[model samples]
Target chain A: DAGVTQSPTHLIKTRGQQVTLRCSPISGHKSVSWYQQVLGQGPQFIFQYYEKEERGRGNFPDRFSARQFPNYSSELNVNALLLGDSALYLCASSLSTGEGYTFGSGTRLTVV
Target chain B: ELKVEQNPLFLSMQEGKNYTIYCNYSTTSDRLYWYRQDPGKSLESLFVLLSNGAVKQEGRLMASLDTKARLSTLHITAAVHDLSATYFCAVSWATSYGKLTFGQGTILTVHP
Candidate 1:
């Protein structure tokens, strides 16, 4: 079986630019979440979607948003990015709400 | 707010040494996860501890969780260079779906 997969393995953007990172959850998984991992720090929760509905959100600003599709795929969008937004954006999926997660290879975003 | 803390953020040890990394969370959570991430890469699931006193092992690494104490530990036995990576512990609250609060990660380096 295939694990969670993400696209655009690497991206480079400038301040005030917007970027989107995509994720395809493992088959039969209905929950998708997004996280940001800055260098030297742990991954921080950003948003979660389950059954195509928003389930939870983290302490991130409004500029960070995400959505889930009917097929259980997800996309994370960051608007008006700043240099500090440069980080690895990870997408994780689980079979259910309280199950263990499988993460994708993540997209490394560089904001200049 | 749920908070996860990890001890010995950076560990340097010789091969064949034994070490343990602790993860403590501030809230009650039934599901805990251990993940490994190499530099510039995404996370790899190592263990999923579902309840108190639960233990799971893969290769030379073992993970246990104590729900009553909201604590988990990842023990490395006879560490090898290939086992060197950043380990993170994550927890999910009962109400959240696919949302995980992660610790600051423990970076392990094994030398000969």
Candidate 2:
């Protein structure tokens, strides 16, 4: 079975610009979560959606937002991008809230 | 706030050596996860430790969790060049749904 998949393997944006990264969870998965991984660091949680409802949010600023579709696909939106926003955006999916997660290939965003 | 910390942020070891990566969390969690990520790639799930004293292994990699101590460890046995990558540990509290706090990754370089 195909694992979680993300779109636009790479992206480039300028300061103050906005970008949206998309993810499609594995088949039959009901939970999706987003994470940001900067160079030389671990991924930081951004948001999580389960059953089309917002379940948790991370320490990210309001400029970052996300939503899940009825089919369990997800989108992570970042506004007013800063150079610091350049990182690999990862999407993970799982069977349920407390289960092990499967991650996507991630979209590498480069903010100029 | 929940936090996960990893030790030996970077490790370079000779092939066939054994090493352990440690992960500690600030609060009790129901599940701990170990993931491997190659440079410029997405994450691959390695092990999922679900309860206190839980231990799981795959090939030459093994992971164990100590919930009471809020600690987890990923042990590499006879490391190989193919194991060169970054290892991350994440934790999710019982009430959390798809929200994971990740430790700063430990970059492992296995030299042949």
Per-residue C-alpha lDDT of model 2 across residues A1-112, encoded as one tens digit per residue: 8988899999999999999999999999999999999998888889999999999998899999999988889999999999999999999999988888999999999999
TM-score of 2: 0.96
Tens-place lDDT digits, model 1, residues B14-63: 99999999999998887899999999999999998887899999989999
Lowest lDDT sum, 10 consecutive residues, model 1 chain A, at A93-102
Clashing pairs in 2: none
Candidate 2 positional error at A40, Å: 0.9
TM-score of each: 0.97, 0.96
TM-score for chain B of each model, two decimals: 0.98, 0.97
Give the DockQ of candidate 2: 0.90
lDDT, candidate 2, B62-92, per-residue tens: 9999999988999999999999999999888
For candidate 2, the clash count comes to 0
TM-score of chain A of each: 0.98, 0.98
